[model samples]
Target: MEASPARRPHRLDPAGGCPHAVNARLLARGAVTPVELPGGIEGMAVLGHAALKEFLQHPEVAKNQRHFTALREGRIAAGWPLLTFATVQGMTTADGDDHRRLRSLAGRAFTPRRVEELRPRIERLVAELLDGLERAAEAGGGVADLRRHLALPLPMSVISELLGVDVEFRDRLHHLSSVVVATDTGPADAVAANRELVAVLGEIVAAKAARPGGDLTSALIAARDEGGDRLSHQELIGTLLLMIVAGHETTLNLITNAVRALCAHPGQLDLVRAGRASWADVVEETLRWDSPVSYFPFRYPVRDITVDGTLIPAGTPVLAGYSAAGRDPAAHGADAGRFDVTRPARPGSVRHLSLGHGTHYCLGAPLARLEATVALERLFTRFPGLGLGVPEAGLTPHAGFVGNSVHALPVLLRR
Candidate 1:
């Protein structure tokens, strides 16, 4: 008798430990499958490489929530756990002409050349963070949370510096940002956090406007002041919020995931230390092996679109399975599940969907990579014998769907 079809995931647990494992199951059920979003929501998730790559650039697809029919018609309930994705407005939600216009303002300031120029600053920050970790370990027993001491603060400082937010603003911003990304947050708390983040960022944007300085926030203010094609007040605040939180979080995960990968796989760690694989290799492999983001929500179809015979109705939310795409055996071969620093580059296959694709791709990709590379290299150089403080099984996953990292990356910083 012929085998029955593989079952699609009943519901996606954003707070679950392993998104890659979930993605592996989904792969057997074709590229596109209907997934149960949190709160009994139904949506399509694209897990395969080729389908994801093709559809990401599809002309009929859009990022704007206006295209989301359920939301537009009030079918979605209030206080939904995933409401943060739909509500936060800025570069992330814009499309077509608006996206290009908004992206241009920051893009000009954040080109790869400019990101590279920040290397010295990034390096300095990495060194300082490393010092803090050492001090933390010395003061508080023998272990420090690497995610907190190093991974969390490195990119947070870099992005805040870029945006001109003072040291005082970062702690609150970090807390609120965490709330928004967390899957466990109730709808009330999540929306509340988003509002507070917006308000705080609004104040910062205003401060930059009143007292202009040599920062991206000031540059954006200048764009608004010299009014041809410019950012509206809402857009300005939204953009700042997006950059600070999203920028900080993505790099944080990149650094955290890299460290975890290296520590967990001693042979892979050997490859890096023995001069066989470079730090860049670690970054690339980590991105593929464990993407910072698992599944991002709500890519509304402008009209009906089909992938691999699965019908995605227009205005339906299509989740981008970045974590899934990374482990797609179809794209990375049978051993895609393994974390190898020296994974060879595939000529025509999707190398990694961690950074993303097409217009909605991450603008902060280069900066994230630069920060992770420096952070990883400097971190290991400081503590060659760094290892997980707790057993790998004991490590708690970040309690959020969007972030694919642990809640706390506890590490023993000395031999």
Candidate 2:
């Protein structure tokens, strides 16, 4: 049955966190469909390519929590798993001038020049990680979980090094961050994770303030504004948390998804081998094929808003259905479901909103693209015969609606 109404959105894929499945169901209903969040929370999902792009740039909507009436009125109870997205003071939850202010400060470390400069370091890191992967395969008799051996560590190390997050805190933060993003996390654990995430980041910010270094954390700490415009203590910690989670998690999955896609569709890898496509094509296609972030959370409408006849009540969180938009058949054509490295770009529109659009666009996008591209090129070159060690069905989706990726990807370095 179709969604009854925006007030009672159709139930989405709760047991399985497959975006394509969810997208297919929601897309069949309409461009904008109301859906139920994990905690019995009602929200709207924009799953169409055209409609999602429009709403992402919609002037009527804002991501700031102040506009969320349910939250402000305490209707959204404490310990809700989705509260982190709503209560976090980072740019992800900020809108308007506040967003601009926060984004401006964080953007300094991720400029084209800065991101390009990291290319050399990233290459070195990729090389080292490949060595680790080789060791893992040797120990495992030519089998390895690439996600654990390579994909996860690459971005985690890069972001941690860039932000100067200590190695000691990396694993701790990763565990906490995983819980914070996963929808299926239990209420009590979710609340504890959110609180501990803030506490951990607060310690990082405090350390940076005491003895600053030539790192993003120190730079953000030192950034000041005339007329009392500055990143407050809470905002500073939130920014660090945002950088760690957004910077690492998104790119980790991007690399993982790209590798998974290429391995699953070896013909696409053959195309790259025949000079029909480049690693850049692989990266972009993977993004369009299996977007890392599935349903980016919590863009609230200041007033009741209607998109293509579906009404999203004011103050209800609107999840951006990015993974759905990536594979929308309407905009991408009937063959959209098939992964094509040579897929033609849709004219007059941005390639895809995987990295988002307009003002709230991801600040670390360049870095992410660079990391994925370099990592893929080096990985494929280093392990020419790499293939999945397990059946396709063996790959399991993470138990979270917001993040779309398999929990683990096992592969054979050589068959």
Kindly list the per-residue Cα lDDT of model 2 for residues 1-415, writing each as its tens digit: 2223544477655444667875886788888888877767778888898989888888999998888877787778677777888888889988778888988888988998999999999999999999999899899988889999888999999999999998989999999998998777777898889889888987887787788899988888876423277787778888888889998899989999999999889999999999999988988888888999888888988887778667777888898988988999998999878899999798887767899988888899999999999999999898999999899899998778888789998889972
- Per-residue lDDT of 34 in model 2: 82
Task: Please give the lDDT score at residue 44 for candidate 1.
Answer: 82
Cα deviation of 155, candidate 2, in Å: 0.6
Number of clashes found in candidate 1: 0
- Write model 1 residue lDDT over 1-415, tens digit each, in one string: 2323434545877566667666777788778888887777778888887888877888999999898887888877676777767766687898989999889989976799999999999998888889999999988787999999999988899899988999989999999988887877887897788889888988888788789999999998888888776887778887887898788998888899999998999899898899999999999999999999888876888887777666778988898888888888888889989999989989966578878899888899889989999988888888899998899999888887778988888899874
Q: What's model 2's lDDT at 119? A: 92
**Clash totals for all candidate models:** 0, 1
| Cα TM-score per model | 0.95, 0.96
**TM-score between candidate 2 and the true structure:** 0.96
Q: What's the lDDT for residue 206 in model 2? A: 79
Off by over 4 Å in 2: 1-8, 13-16, 224-227
Q: What is the Å distance of residue 288 in model 2 from its true position?
A: 1.1
lDDT of 1 at 1: 22
